[model samples]
Target: MDLNALDDFQLVAAHGGFGRASRASGRSKATLSRRVTELEEALGVRLVERGARSLQLTEAGQQLLARTEGPMYEVADAIAAVREGVATPRGNLRIAAPSLFGQLALGTLVARFRTLYPDVEIEVVADDRRVNLVEEQFDIAIRIDPDPDTALVGRCFARDRLVLAAPPLLAPPSGDLDEVVPVPAVVMPSYREGDIWTLRDRAPRLLPRPVLRLSSLLMVRDAIVAGAGVGLVPQSIIGGQLQRGELVSWGTRGGDVALWVLHTSRRLQSPKVRAFVEFLCDQYPDKAFLASV
Candidate 1:
C-alpha cells in the first residue's frame, strides 16, 4: 500500500474531511481527493463515504484505520528520527492533563521546559473530560485513573492521597471519622454519580446525607476555606493549607490515587515526546505528593 495515501487518509480523518485536510495539509482539494481515491483503489475498499458536505469513514475504513494508525505513526517517527538526531528536542508536544493540575501545578514545569528547550513548542490542553489519544492527536495525557488498554503506554508518575478536610474552625475533631464526617461536605463533579460516598476500609455512606456538593475543586477549596462543609481533596492540593491551619482534616482518610501519564508507544519513540516525559518524571519530584499520601 502507498504510505502517502495512508497519510492523506489519516490527515482527512484528523481534520474532519478532505476539504479541511487539504487546507491543513497544504494540498489542493482535487489533489488530495485523487490521492485518497488512489489509496482506496489500492486498499480495495471504500475508505470514505462520498457526500456533498461531510465525509464519514465506512466500517471497513474504520477497521483499516485502527490497524494502520500505529504503523503510520511509527513510520512518521522513524522519518523524524532520521531527520533530527538525538541532541536537540524540537517539535510540538501536545499535552492534556486534568484542568486543575494543568492550570495550577504545571505552570512552573511548563516554564522550565520552554526555557530548557526553546525550540520545542508546548500545547497544553486543560480538560476535565477524558480525551481519545489517537483521534485527538495528543502526544501526552495525565490521567488520574487506571488504563486498561495495553496498546498505550501508561506509567504512574506519583501517588496522591485523598484527604477529607475543611477550615480549621469548621473541621471536626480528628479521631473518629464516622462521627465527625457528617458535617456538611463539598464534592467534585466526578463523584456525583450515586450521591453515596465510600471510604476505603469502610462501607458506602450516603450524602446530602449531610453536606453540600460541588463540581470544581477550586470551588470546593474556596468553600472549605470559607468555613463551608468538609471536602475530600488531593493532599497535593491541600497539604500547605493543613500546615498553615487554613484547612484541617475531616471525615475518612487514607485512599491513595495514581497519577498516570498516558501516551502511545509510538509517541514514546519520538525524541521530543521522550524528552518531555523524562523531564516530567525527573524534575517533578513525586516525593512531595507521596510524603503526604
Candidate 2:
C-alpha cells in the first residue's frame, strides 16, 4: 500500500479517530476518511472497526501497526543517522560544570571533543553553583557528588579523592604529626555545606572543619599551592603537583569523592551525550586514580 495511507493509519491510531487525526495530521476529516478507506481497499482488509463514539483497530490494523512501528522507527533512525553523520554532532552542546573541573579537566576534553566533532560547539558554563539541567538547557554537567534529581542520569567517569595538603613551605611549624596548623583556606561556599570538610577516615575517626573558608575549589587549590593554607582538592587534579612537590598530602590515601557526567535521564542514550560520557570515562580511569590514592 502507499506510504501516505500508512501515514494516515498511523495518525488515526495515534490520535484515536479520523476527526482528531485529521486535525493533528493537518488533513481534513473527509480527506483522512478517504485515505483510510483507500488504504483498507488497497490492503483488501477492514483495518478499523467502526463504533458510535470511537474507532478500534481490527486484527489486521493492530498487526499492521505493530509491524510498521519498528520499521518506521528504523527508517526515522536511518534518516537521523545520515543527518547526524552529515552534520557531525553539529550543534551547540551546552555544558555546566564546577569551576575547578571546568578549568582543569573540561578544557582539554572539550578541545579533544571539538577536534573529533569539529562542527559541534561546546559551550562551557563554569560555575560552582548547581544548575537545573532541563531549565538551563544544558546538554551535560560534570558533577562531583550524587545527582539527587531522578530526572538526571549520572554516568560514572571516575572517583576522585579530596587531598588535604599544604605547600611544602607551610608543612607544619613544629614538623609534628599531631600539630594542626590554623591556616587560611578558601573553600566551597556554605551553600554546599560548611559543617564538613571531608577527610580520609581512620577505621573509627572522622574529621571535618576548615580553619578559613571561601567559595570555590579552584580558589582553594590556588591558595593551598601558593602556601596560603591547607585545603581539600581532587587528587586527579593535583597528581602532577603532588609528584612535583608543589603540594604535600596530609593523609596517605586522600579523601573520597566520585566524578560523574550528569545528563537528562531521557537523553542519557542520545548519541552526542553518550559519546562525551564515554570519552570522559576513558580519560579518567578509576584504576589510575585508585593507584594514586
Candidate 3:
C-alpha cells in the first residue's frame, strides 16, 4: 500500500471530512477522496462511508486510524527534528493538563512561553481524564501525582499537598490538636462515608460530614468560600484565597504530591518539547511556584 495514500486517508479521517481535509492540506477534495479510495482498494476494505452532508469511518477505518496516528506523528516529528536541527522552536505544541492546573497556572505559563518562542503554536486541553500522550498526539502533559508508567518520561517540576480550607466563621474551633473534629464538608464524589482525613504528622483528624459533593476541586473551593462547608483542596489552587483570608487553612493533609511534565518515551525530544520542558523548569527552579500556585 502507498504511504501517501494512507497518509491522505488518515488526514481525511482526522479532520472528519474530505472538504475540511482539503482546506487544511491545500489539496483538492477530489484528490483526497481518490487517495482514500485507493487506500481502501489496496487494503480490500471500505474505510469511509461517504455521504452528502457527513462522513463516517467504518470499524476497520477507526481501528486503522487509532493504530497509525501515533506512529505517523512520530514520523513527522522525526522529519521536523532533522529539518530544523537545534534550531528555533517552530510548530504546533499540544498539551494536556489537569483542569485545576490548566485554569490556575497553565495559561500564564503558555503566554510567557509564546512570547519567548513566537514560532511555537500551543493548544492546551484541560481535563482530569488521563490522556494517552502517543494516541492523543500530545506534545506534553502536566499531571499531579501520576502513577508509574514505563512509557512516559519527564521531570517532576513541583510538589504540592492537599489542605483543608474553610471560611473563618465556619472553621472548626482550634481546641484540641488530637481531637477528631466532625466538620460539615464539601467534598469530591470520591469521598465516601466514614472516610476520615488524616492530617500530616498526626495533626487533628477531620471526620468530614459531607454537606455537599462537587465533581471538581474548583467547585469545591467556591462552595467552601460560599460557606457551604469546609473542603479539602490542593494548596496550589487556593493560595490566593488563603493569603487573602478568603479561606483559612485547617491544616495540611497527608504527604506531598509531585507535579510532573511528561512526554512519551518512544518519541524523540522535539525542539518544541525540549523548549517547553526547559521553560517550565526555569520558571520553577526550586519547585516552589507550583507548590504555592
User: Top lDDT: which candidate number?
Assistant: 3
Residue-wise C-alpha lDDT for candidate 1, range 233-268, written one tens digit per residue: 777777778788899765455567777778889542
Per-candidate local distance difference test: 0.75, 0.72, 0.87
Candidate with better TM-score, 1 vs 3: 3
| Higher-ranked by lDDT: 1 or 2 | 1
Window of ten residues with lowest summed lDDT in model 2: 197-206
Q: Model 3, stretches more than 4 Å misplaced? A: 1-86, 171-179, 266-268, 289-293
Residue-level lDDT tens digits of model 3 in 1-293: 78789899999998999999999999999999999999998999999999997899999999999999899889888989778765778889999999888888889999999999998999999998999898899989999888999989999898888888989887455545667778899999998899978776545677889999889888999999899989889888888888898999877888888899999863667888999998998888888646433
User: How many residue pairs clash in model 1?
Assistant: 1
Give the runs in model 1 whose Cα sits over 4 Å from its true position: 1-83, 171-181, 189-212, 251-254, 266-268, 286-293
Each model's TM-score, in the order given? 0.62, 0.60, 0.67
Preferred candidate (lDDT higher): 2 or 3:
3
lDDT of 2 at 241: 80
Candidate 2, residues 1-293, lDDT tens digits: the string is 78777878888987889878877767898888888899999989999987777999999999999999778778778989887764345667889987777777678888988887777778999987988888889988888776477788867777767676778886433333343434445455662433333234422122334555666666677778887767667676678788899988765344467777898875325667767777777777762452222
Which one wins on TM-score? 3
